[model samples]
Target: MSSSSAVKRLLNYAGEKKILLILASIFSFFSTVLMVVPFGSVYFVIRELLTNANDISAIPGDRLILCGWIALGALILGFICLYIGLFFSHFAAYQILYNIRVRLSKHLSTLPLGYFTKGSSGAIKKILDSNVEKIESFTAHQIPDLVSAFLMPLIMIMTMFILDWRLAIATVIPILIGYFIQAAVFSSDSGRKAMEDYQHSLEKMSASGVEYVRGMPAVKVFGMTMDTFLHFKSTIYDFRDWAVSYTKLCRRPYMIYLVMLTSILTFILPVGVFILSGQPDNQAFALTFLLFLTVAPSLSTPMFQLMYLGGELQKITEGNRRIDAILNEKPIAEPVHPKVASSYDVRFENVSFSYQEKGDQEYKLALKNVSFTAPQGKITALVGPSGGGKSTIASLIPRFWDIEEGKIAIGGVPIQAMATNHLMETVSFVFQEVHLFHDTIEENIRMGNRNPTRQDIISAAKLACCHDFITSLPDGYDTKIGEEGVFLSGGEAQRITIARAILKNAPIIILDEATAFADPENEANIQKGLNALIQNKTVITIAHRLSTIRHADQILVLQDGEMVERGTHSDLLALNGLYKKMWNAHLSSKDWGLQEREVHHHE
Candidate 1:
């Protein structure tokens, strides 16, 4: 989209605060005018001295002192106006940014949970952090500075024309040439491609840097250096190389533009000499020519500033387009007449779901014709090999993605009819990967409930079998996690999440390998926590370690996105179907590990 459209969208977010920006621009415009008063004063003072050049004693000393004082006062007032303008602009910009961020975050909450997969997280963060920051930079700094930059030259050119229209016309020639040169360079296909490529490479490099930091533990364990992270290393090198090449390519053109600006006097000098030669006795004309020399070249700085701001505005507007992408994204549609689920039995009937669909090269269903009943107050375990629709089944209960064809219901009511908040309140999730905020342990647990007492937090932690461990820390529940705080082990972190779920105590629980990362001891402890959590709740769990779900009320064995075999543990084994084969394989894996250890011990 065009830059104006992008900027207009940002101003929409500014809402009523648009007034502050206007005020800022007005004040800055006046400030810019006042700032040039000192220069104007210099012109008058010089002309006065030159008029008395034949007799230095006839110089207007009083008038000269008044002019200097006026210059100083105008300079001081200009700075004051500048400060006020900056204050208003910054305050308005910050408020607008805060509103946009909050609105964007709330919108994100309404999107499908699966929309925030691990791979897309970096891009999302950039949109929120740096991309959002871009709009603020454009509005707060650039616009006001552009006002100043724009006005300075216009004011100087006007003053120049008043002094000597000939010199003023000459002064504008180099500026116009410089402007065309900048416009030509900036509007080039190669120039645009260079900027796009630079941004693309920078994002890649940033994402790689984040990945490297995240995988540092693995790298450290493997005794790997920065060079060992070849993808990251390559991205860094690529960014550096591209920057160097782009700079080298643009160097000559930019240098030429700078020459045109710095050599503004060269264009006006010959013209000035010609004018002076025509009026040899006009000492007043000579002084005015000298004043043009001083004032005209100074305009170049602001002219160059305006050009630079224009280029930066393009980049920021591009970033604003990304910000708009998120803002424009439609949130998950809410039901017109929202329904509530009185009973929490999750049923999936004739369900067909797929991440890939039409237009995708691979359109394989993750779940197809999968029907199951996870009855209330009983644990229904989904057991299968990887990619067999086990986790997909668990996720579907919470409506992460609407199925192409299915009747998914909670309490016999279609889930699509349920209000999003109602559906969320009805279900609690404990996935394989645990997420805890960088806050105190108490605060982390309190996220499950809007308002929980310290005692409530401790009580929930105790039920999840993490209270003892938490209390053992120096600060107890007050202890923080992640940054500036202690990091928990996989087991410990999982227990913390379990504690959060217990605190939430939703009637429906979806567990996707809740104990996947735990050690045997931790797994046993996690199971104890899960026991307390799933009591009299509709528990639909996905597990690879079939033994963990051996005593589940029901077992659904899936393969290739279809339910192949399903029954109670013993009943499935007796059928001698896929479930039985999986059970045997599970048993063999344990024996194989034991046998390998025994062989190693013998050796």
Candidate 2:
């Protein structure tokens, strides 16, 4: 964060459109003095047509119509100062890229949802849409062509040293040796490590083309053809062979800065016409033909506007270093004096956890000195088996990922003292991959109470039985739901995510296996919409279906992460052990599915 503090945070996002970028840099410095005053007006109209060819018939006709109206008003004032300096440099680069995408989307809505599970919704959608459109192509076109490429080469080398200080010291020694050989071939750290290895092979070919178009329907329902899309066609041919070997290694220092700027403008305008034709001062040969026609088109117009803003200033310094690594990350702990509880229970006292990941540092507890509670208004259940930590104790009762050593309360305060949006507005989860948003099943059940109406989203989609297939589709609750809803069915997207956790009447739900992937008649209509959204709330439930927590009032179990066994369901099936071998293997698989449906109802 110091290349002069990343160029002063890209000039403080163009200092909030600093008066239309200082009136587009004063109309790009009077449009580079009307485009280098047409190379000193075609070198004084070819040195007055070769020194007034025998007084060109006594020079009159109103001075040849005042030199054709000052050469058509200097080509219409150099096309109206280059169209008002490219219309105020693209209106101050789209108002500083719409205020850095609204301050990085309001700093990603105050961060901390475990910073989006440590990145990768295609690498945070390629850092919020192609790295904030490469900082809006460097503030709307390479920062006004890098401030008119250093003010048109320092106003054409101070008007070529006031027109002939020995032909501006022989045209600034081959334009400073072709700008130090194009700045040693574009400041090579092997050409910025070949443009950061062609932007990490184009962000790993856009995160393997968004994981091969979202795993193309599970790679065509598992057949996985086209050679399993050969790692997304070899990462788009290794980003087209590293963009043709970084455009042939940037065309050898751009053809050696165009042959050292055409051999220093053809050897300083023929050695300033043999030292101004042995000048006896004919006004120093008309000021060395108007400073060699304003230093020969201001020597490649500021090195072609700094080589056309060197790839938008390297994608605006890699989009302000990926929006300053998500506005300087950190945030997770939060909560100072917060507290807002009003009845949800939860609690996990001598708790401990782990999981860390990125460049590890030894942390894998996944729950250790575990303790439990769940209480306030009933149903607990937890069971275990697979990895046993039971969904990391329901993701630490909503702190998502926290508990390193102890406390995790709720009704008795300490969820780090509360406010993580007041403990996710009194918790409520569901999970087992439900999602749902391509909008409108009453706006995804009014995103759990945005101002839910239309009869409170049809009474929370009729208490999550999903209002008879959402009023039988066809734009019932304004249909839509395509993307994540993918036209429903995993028991209608888990009863539209249990009618968005029963319109987020959140008092503390959790769920996790949420009827695992229902189907016994959508798990008896999702166990009657989870008994009308868990009647007294503070539920919990994790169940790998030991008959859906057989009316759980308390259970526990776990294994690797500790809590050996606890209560209910005939007191853990009268202590036979691991919840009576998981409730006698779910009542011997529901008594062989009711004896094969009573032998198919007697055939």
Candidate 3:
């Protein structure tokens, strides 16, 4: 995106508070005008002194003192106005940032789950956190400063030309050259590419850092060193190299810009001398010389601001582009006129789905032309090896990703036609992996119901068989249970998640190996809880253990994204197909485990 377009988009985020920008401009103009007042007072004082060259002491002492006071007052007032303008801009800018963050968050919620899975959490966090923060520099500091920078130069140019056109040329020429040099440094294709690479390196470093932290347990177990942790170490080195290169590229131009600004008097002094040679009025020459000596160098000060703001502008524009890209991502379309499911029965009619890998146009089919009927108030179990589209089927019922072909319906209504919130309300999920918030056990259980009662929470916890363990904690139900707080075993954490699902009590329940972590004892208790929750409800389960789904009303076996078989447990066994083979394998594994335990006991 063009810098102007990015800036305009950023300004639009301020919404109705754009009047603050106008107010800042007015204040900046005043700040510029006041800044010149001191110079004007100094010039008049010098002129008076030059005019009274024969009798310097004859100059009015009161007038000189008044001039000094006026100069001091103008400078103070100028700064005060500038500060006031900044205060408003900063307030408005923060408000805009807050609004944009909120908007982006809500938009992200509407996107498909696949989007979150496909991208790194750290990269997403960087966009939401760091990228959004950079806009503050543009709106709050740069906006007002840029206005003052441009305005001050324009005012100085006018004042200089009125004083002496030759001096104006000498003063402005270096500033113009410096301005172009700064622009060339910031706006060039190579410079922009370097900045983009720098940003990419930082993002890679952030993602790698998060991955490294998460993999620390495995790293420790494997006895790995930093050098062996290739991704994280490489990202660190990449960021260092890019940062050094970017600095090297910018260092020369920045130094030269500074030098050019500081040497404005070098150019004007010679021109002033040349002008003075032909002039008979030595007093006029001396007065003009004094003005050029004081004011000309100060013009370069605004050039400094311009130079600084150039880099900031590039960063802000890049940040705006990233924010806009997220905002532009297509959200799962919500039906304008939503249709609510009348029954909990789920149906997949020749549904096909493929997940597209980012940066590559390749597609991997998770499910292909899958057809099935999950009758209302009955269990439909999906059994398959890992990556065989079992979880993909369960996900389709909730419209996690829209099918590429055919239709998925809940209660005879197409899931896509249902309101997203209504569809979510219809299905409750208990996955193999559960995430608990860093909060009290009671709060975590009550997450399903926004207005849950104490009794309701306690009842759900009791049904999930976690009430006893929760009460054993120091704070009982209120004990915090995340990173900094208490830790629960896999089974215990799973039970808490079951409590959450039980509380939601959605009509259609999906259990993706929910008992995967539980011991036989806890597993039996969890089964009791699931029985209570799934009564008279439509259920679709993904089971790795064939024993758990033996009594399912209908069992569909998936292999490589397509249904290979469908029948009752006995019927599948009689068929002697994939299901029969899987059942035999499951039985052997169970018996082998028991045999191992028996041998240990004998020893």
Candidate 4:
């Protein structure tokens, strides 16, 4: 996108606060104008002293005192105006940041789960946190400073020319030269490439840092050192190298820019002397020289600010681009008129789906023409090896992603046509990976029901076999879950999530490895909870443990994203097909595990 368009988008996020920004700019302009007042007063005093030639009586003492007071008052007023402008700008800056973050978060929520899984969380976090903060810095601090910087130069030029045209022309020459050097440094192809590389290095460093911290447990368990993790260490070194290289590239141009600015007086002095040679009076020349000395050095201040702001704007522009990618992601389209399901029977009619990565041109088929019927009040189990499209099947029921082909329906209504709220109300999920908020155990369970009573939470907890353990804690159901208080075991956390599903009590239920991590005793208790949740509901379970789904009304065996066998437990064993082979493997693995433990006990 064009830089102007990005800037316009940034302003749009400010909403009504743009008016305050404009007002701040106006105050900044007046503040910039006042900076020259002191210099002007100094010029008049110097003119008096030069003309009087050390005769104190000839010089007006009252006028000199008045000039000093006026200079001081104008400086104070200028600072006060700058303070007010900054206050308004900062207020607008924070509001804009709030809007931008909210907009990004809300858009992210509407995107499919796959989007989050495909992208790096660390990179996303960096954009949302650090890059967004940079926008705030630019708006609140840099914008007002930039306005004053540009305005000061313009106002000073006008005043200087009015006072003495020759001195004004001399002062501007060095500033113009410095501007060209500054532009060449930033606008060149190599300069732009270095900036891009710097931004990439920063993102890589953030990602590497997050990965290193997250992998600490694994590193500790394996007795590995940081030096052994080559990728993480190399990423840090790469970032350092890029930073050092960028500094080296800019060093020469920056030094040249500074030298040109400082030499303003060097050029001004000789120019003033030459102009005075043609003049009849030497006193006017002395006054002009003094005025040039007063204002020329301060002229570089605004230019320095502009140079810094230019670099900052490039980074902000990149940040805006990242945010726009998220905002532009197309969500699963909702129907204009939604249909409601009358029954709870789930049907997959020749449904085909594929996993498509962000830049991939071809879809990787996860499920190919999969067809099934999960009748209400019955248990339909999916038995499969890892990466066999079982979880994909469960995710599709809730429209986590739209199918690439065919139709999935509940009660004869296509899921694509169902209202999202209604679809959410119809299905409840319990996956292997359980996430609980860092709140009270009671509140976590109550997430299933928005306005659930305390008694409703207790009842669901009891049904899920979690209430007894919860009550054993210091605060019972009110106990916090994370760092602040009691921490639940894997089984206990799983049961808590099961309690949430039980509380939701939707007509259709999906259990994706619900008891995968449980011990035998915990498994039995969790099965009891699952039985209670499955009652009178259409249940589609993806089972890793063959023993748990032996009693399922229907079992479908999937391999390589396609259903290969379908039968009851007895019938599958009789067929001696893929299902039978999987069952035999499960039995063999269990016996091997038991024997290993028995031998350890003996030792």
Tens-digit lDDT track of model 3 for 152-270 = 88897898898788888988888778778777877899888987887778788899888888899999999987899999999999998998988898888788878888899899988
lDDT of 2 by residue, 163-214 (tens): 6666666667766776676667556676666666666677777877888877
TM-scores of all predicted structures: 0.93, 0.41, 0.94, 0.93
lDDT score, residue 229, model 3? 98
Q: Which stretches of candidate 4 lie over 4 Å from their true place?
A: 1-7, 164-166, 188-193, 280-282, 357-363, 594-603
* Range of the 10 consecutive residues with the lowest summed lDDT in candidate 2: 593-602
Instruction: Give the winner by TM-score.
Output: 3
lDDT of 1 by residue, 253-286 (tens): 7787888889889988999999888889887778
Residue lDDT tens for model 4, 490-595: 8899999999999999999999878988898898778888888989999999999899899999999998889988889999999989899999999988877433
Q: Give the Cα error of residue 446 in candidate 4, in Å.
A: 2.4
> Candidate 1, after superposition: displacement of residue 480 in Å?
1.6
- Any residue pairs clashing in model 4, and if so which? none
